[model samples]
Target chain A: MVVAEFVSELRARFGIEFKDLSILDEAFTHSSYANEHRELGISDNERLEFLGDAVLELTVSDYLYRKFPNLPEGELTRMRAAIVQTKSFSSFSREAHFDKYIKLGNGEEAAGARQRNTLLEDLFEAFCGALYLDQGRAAVIKFCQQVIFPHIDAGEFRGISDFKTALQENLQQDGNADIHYEEVSITGPGNARQFNIDVYVDDKLLGSGSGKSKKRAEQAAAKAALVGLGVIS
Target chain B: MVVAEFVSELRARFGIEFKDLSILDEAFTHSSYANEHRELGISDNERLEFLGDAVLELTVSDYLYRKFPNLPEGELTRMRAAIVQTKSFSSFSREAHFDKYIKLGNGEEAAGARQRNTLLEDLFEAFCGALYLDQGRAAVIKFCQQVIFPHIDAGEFRGISDFKTALQENLQQDGNADIHYEEVSITGPGNARQFNIDVYVDDKLLGSGSGKSKKRAEQAAAKAALVGLGVIS
Candidate 1:
């Protein structure tokens, strides 16, 4: 349940031993702990958490993109989001038994903050940041792919279907529908141009949407139409 | 044009020729072209585009995340968006002179569609997808590092400063002004709590923010207060 035990478990899980356990210690130390023990001279996990969040997102995103070459952009983005979100990160932390190893102040421990999602997510990010700094991006990438990507890939069967494709396919299948996408208006000038698109199915307005581009607007309109028709959840 | 000529041109710009030019041609072919020329028995670039988009995002996100070890999530997310956006994809397509090689239908060509953002973006995505499938993930990562990562890295020096640090340093130096963050509300169920936090200086509310956790909310509040006080642009 101590920080040392946590590092041993993490090392076993990640297959990388810490050269400086101080990095791991700092990563597990919350600001509350620092606040309570001012003389510790240890920087809290906030900065490391901040760095690790980026590192995690990047590593996971790269891995998924490479492995799943057939997935669309929106699907990839959502998958990356699902993996990096607090909920996912917390699960990873919990699986790592993060609560057992976190170094919290007496006040925080008294407050019963061991299972806090915020704490878990921050700790996971901090851990990732520490791993990256100590081992390198390659190690971080391998750790993430091993620890996180499987959960995301497993969820691919459920809760993560391609909404864009679903919408497009549904529209196309409806009596071989002739979907007319018109750029109704383009507001603003230069990079600010907001394209408004109206999707018509044989002159009946299926949906309307606005985006930076007419194609995106059409895609949005298609997405809205799918929601309107209960084609996508 | 012959596939050899096309590969050489791409090699000049992309610096990597395909072991097979079929992938590149497959990437360049649009659905409209396939529909028009049924004899070619070739599928369009949509599937490849979908795949490529994922590869592009993952590659760019991975590069950005590792390249800048200390950037906050928001800034990193924004940078990812900027790099993988339609505009960026279009630029990439232009750089490769994709306009000259893309196989579009007569109707699309008449509509000046070769220069279209959607078409260019799709072509770029397809190109990536084809490259990934043909050469593998390692090749894609190498291509991304050579083609996309450098551009993203160039923008890194512009907008990735730590807002929280800037805010704290500014407030602390101003006659020892104590900065405080308090959680105003904690809503939702066990795992999905929404936290609202307010940043205060001497009992005066500087900024408030809401996030999935208190730490995030505090960071958001700090970010807002920094911008509000003109501590960061």
Candidate 2:
């Protein structure tokens, strides 16, 4: 694609015009592209990706802090991780149609590198980095607030099996209730040990489950309790 | 110490007074302290620490990006890691006299938790978090630019061996030099293996070293080359 068209697309999509087009150019340029165009003095997106990773983290963190005043640190961390994971970021890039603009070497393009999760994730981050450099933090935050924060608010990215934390947060809403996990049984040989655990909320049994380890069993019990509490489908 | 005295110390040290002293209070309150003071509705610094961690990373990443324009992503990552590491951050906390301000439970205080590196590191992050909340990103950036950036600039936290990357950067300054590492020999049993490697800069034998693995041996050779090139003492 032509550079002007790419720039136009970004402007239309992100609602921000780049003061320096070179930063945007660098953001889309893969290392392979830079290597192939060494005489052109083209730089890769890796450095920008590094910078964008930090920017994305900070923006998401600040949003989470303000939005969830009562949420604990662990839950905040988990939620942030879920939002920024490669899968989530790649999905965002796909929605942004990043593959159409990324500049890859002939070989990488032939290898179908554009659709790769790692490349898409890196491109998304580098784009954010470029946006931050060109337009500043306010622009980047606004972009995230529009593109990323809504998904988080909708609870769309809370991947499988975080029910334990979900249940804890639900229970903690009322007050600090005495939540306990008791190992009810241990069986099987040493090499293949199994544990059955029961979860109690305020001295009342909520759920029970079995697993290979105490932690896993507790998580299973929590999942069961969350289901019983109708917190998840 | 009383909350007013804590607020005064923060103002004297940081040159800015918080609009809401409660955020500052939460920043210094350890989980143990919060646990003991549940009735007072005291909050721990962990959440702030989480926010601060992201703020610190973004500020540092931006600083490094601007300061070292020619640095590759890998080296920038390494430098950022060094600057924000637990040891480096804990040292910053110590220099800031964070121990004097942190509120811990009586039991934790008796157990000498004030001197712990982990606690100090957490307090430093929490302080940044509180500053970001009270002032904004600009203030947090200013705080880090004053406190953390200088240490990074001085190369105080480069820590142990990163000679391979250092050597590579030093050689790549005058354009890309052909740097090669070749395994010269492998000896000893499989479980107790030793390998000798030689590092060549532009086809010149600069240094040679031996270690248990190829990676280690290459690093050792790079370190010797750096020493021979008068780059590090």
Candidate 3:
């Protein structure tokens, strides 16, 4: 679509009337296209992607911080990472129809770069970066509220690593003196070692698991305990 | 320091008189102490660390995005990593007297956990997290301005992997069109192979380097080119 269509669609979709559309132009412009048309002096979206990445992170972090007050740091960290990964952003890009406006070099267009997940992720971030530049932090947050938060609030991105925290909150022990994780065994080669851990309460093993690392093992065990306790299905 | 002393000193130092001093109390309380005195019903600072870490990152990222408008994402990532690492936060904690306020269990205190770099880092983050909760986003940003930004502005965190972007910006060419990096050779075992790279500008070899990976080699070459061009000493 044309720039006017792009501007109108953005307004209709996000209520954002960008002051400087040139930043969005840069956002939609890919490195491949920019390289092919260097004479036009159009810059790529990589820088915007960089800045937009941080913007996205902060937005998501703030959302998670406020939304899930009881979740432990480990769970929040995992959720944030998952929310910002290529899959999530790419999906967000597709939903926002940002995929329709990306400018690609002739070769890249033929090579199917238009439908790539990583590219879409970059576009989403670049778009956010441009939005941040055109508007500010509030604009970005509002945009997320419209575009991203619904998915989050509907319980779409739940159940990654908060199991340990869930188990603790279920048992009313705060990952401290009340809860105990015992290392049952160490197995496998040094480089690829696996740890078996058991989560205990009142000196009874409530859950057990083995994983590639101690932390992972502990988390898995906690998840099992949570399930055994019927805290979550 | 006692809570009252901590309160008075914080106001005197940061011009911040928190409405909820309990937040700061939680920030200063370590898990060890809370674990030992379970009946006190006091929570530790881990959650605050988690939130504060994100807050610190956003604060630093916004600063960098504005301050160094020309820096590439790679350089920004490296610089951000350095600034948020244990050493920097530990030093910040010590300087801000956060180290003096930590409430550790007797064993941890006896084992010198008070001076441990990791502990100090957590304290710094927890402190920021507490400050953020007590104040809000603007307060956190302002707190960073008083605490972190000046050190950043002093040119203390330089000589990171921005050489390629620096070289290109110095040459007034963006990353895509004007600059090129060619792989000269690869040697050593599969896991430990080294790459030799050469960077060119206007068909002239400006710099060359060898590194464990292609990106590193390119960055080294860029640094060399920047030095050869006398852009940065």
TM-scores of the models, in the given order? 0.55, 0.74, 0.73
Error of 3 at A59 (Å): 1.6
Fnat per predicted structure, each in turn = 0.09, 0.80, 0.52
Could you list the chain B TM-scores for each candidate? 0.68, 0.69, 0.72
Q: Please give the clash total of every predicted structure, in order.
A: 0, 0, 0
Model 2 ranges off by over 4 Å? A159-229, B158-229
* Tens-digit per-residue lDDT, A1-233, candidate 3: 23788889988988989888788899999877865664585768877887888888878888988887756677788788878899999999999999999999887899899999999999999999989888988999999999889988876777646666667767875445478889888888643567799999879889998876555677889989988888766
Query: What DockQ was computed for model 2?
Result: 0.33
Question: What is candidate 3's lDDT per residue for B1-233, written digit by digit as tens?
Answer: 24788888888998888787788888888877765564575778887888888778878887887887656666777788879899999998988888888999887899899999999999998888888777877898888888888888775675645676567667875445467888898787643567798999877999999876455678888888888888767
Residue pairs with backbone overlap in model 1: none
- How accurate locally is residue B118 in candidate 2, as Cα lDDT from 0 to 100? 92
For model 3, the docking class works out as acceptable
lDDT of 1 by residue, A1-233 (tens): 13566667767876778777888888888877755554455567765675687667667666766665545455666666767778878888998777788888777788888889988999999898888778877888787777787776565432525434555566777567776777687787643567788877778887888875444566677777777888664
What value of lDDT does candidate 3 attain over all alpha carbons? 0.81
User: By the DockQ metric, which is better: model 1 or model 2?
Assistant: 2
Between candidates 1 and 3, the one scoring higher on DockQ is 3
Across B1-233, the per-residue lDDT of candidate 2 in tens digits comes to: 23676667656876768887788888999876765564575668899999999999999999989876755677679888878878978988988778888898877888899989999999999989989988998998877767888876776755535667678889999998999988788787644568798999878999999876455677789989998999887
RMSD of 1: 12.7
